[model samples]
Target: MADPKPALVLHLATGGEPLLFALTTEESGKLAGKLTQLVKAGAVETVTTKDHQEVAINFAHVAAAYLDDLTRKTTVFGMR
Candidate 1:
């Protein structure tokens, strides 16, 4: 079989400086495109895993960031 798809997680800093982002392996590009779109829209900063298997878009400045983090946390881990 082909290499397994890498997981992913997106973390956006909230209530603090030096913005933060946490991502896991299950939340890859294909899984988190909508968030990526938001990143592209200038709503957040996007940070993909080294292998491109995961993606984390920072949206602390946006209200939705907190919501997204909560939803995604149940699915993806904070780290690999």
Candidate 2:
């Protein structure tokens, strides 16, 4: 078997503040590209998570990010 693709998460931040999302790598890349384009075109005013916390976007005062190597493992509920 080939090496598995690295897991990813998207982190949205403004002025060093952050909000995180456990999205798949593909989803993370696509959203990052979309955000960049929208930021360039001034199409995105606000970004939010499933929980509805807003992410403030600023092209000049913003940073890009992604989290990788976040592996998953199976667990049983009453097992220590």
What TM value does model 2 have? Answer: 0.33
lDDT of each: 0.41, 0.44
Candidate 1 — worst ten consecutive residues by lDDT sum? 64-73
Q: What's the CA error at residue 28 for candidate 1, in Å?
A: 1.1
Off by over 4 Å in 1: 5-24, 29-33, 51-80
TM-score of each: 0.24, 0.33
- The numbered model that scores best in lDDT is 2
Q: Candidate 1: which pairs clash?
A: 7-25, 7-26, 7-27, 8-24, 8-25, 8-26, 8-27, 9-23, 9-24, 11-22
lDDT, residue 26, candidate 1: 53
Per-residue lDDT for 1-80 in model 2, tens only? 54333432333444444434444455445566566555455453454433545555444433443434334354232332
Candidate 2 backbone collisions, by pair: none
Model 1 residue 67 CA deviation (Å) reads: 22
CA lDDT, candidate 1, residue 44:
45
Q: What is the lDDT of residue 65 in candidate 1?
A: 34
